[model samples]
Target: MTDVVSYPKGDLRRMLSVLAALESMPEATLVKLVAKTGLDKKTVSNLIIQAGEQAGVQISKSGPIYKLENWGPVIKRSGAKMALTGALNAPIVLA
Candidate 1:
């Protein structure tokens, strides 16, 4: 089985950068993202999907233009420091 713990940090960081770049230019295309991020087209595509899973963000495409939905910076918190485990779909109740 593929180890969920083994998720690549490099791809995460690259996607975060793509998220950042998308902020300034909200109407960029897939090809334009490759040039803007200096990441391969396939790599960018994969990162976009991963970003959706890890965070509650989405990248949508209309024709050739792409845009971000519920977009923001990805803040990585370690298990020890985090208040709760599992996806954010659960309630975030504080003690």
Candidate 2:
């Protein structure tokens, strides 16, 4: 399933890195993405939307909470998911 959608090329690694972390947690928040992935809040927020759009799902934000429902469909179709897998294995500094 993750073999379908193509992830953004080049510098989207940071975005993919964020998504990779989110993938492990059942629920997430903008603050969590920022804290966990070391991405700024505004950057994580924007990147999440961009990542979701590229992955074929809308990453919904509820105040500080964020989530992607049925993310399996979106993720399985995303090349970013693969990159995310790799990103998860790589060392990432937490904010």
TM-score per candidate, chains pooled: 0.60, 0.57
Best by lDDT: 2
Model 1, CA-based lDDT: 0.59
What's the lDDT for all of these models? 0.59, 0.61
lDDT (10s digit) by residue, model 2, range 1-95: 22222334346667666666676566687666666766567777677777767766556667766666545454552676655555446433222
Lowest summed lDDT window (length 10), candidate 1: 77-86
The best candidate in terms of TM-score: 1
Clash number for each model? 0, 3
What's the C-alpha lDDT at position 10 in model 1?
Answer: 62
- Which portions of model 1 show Cα errors greater than 4 Å? 1-11, 72-95
RMSD of each: 11.3, 8.2
Q: Candidate 2's error at 58, in angstroms?
A: 3.2
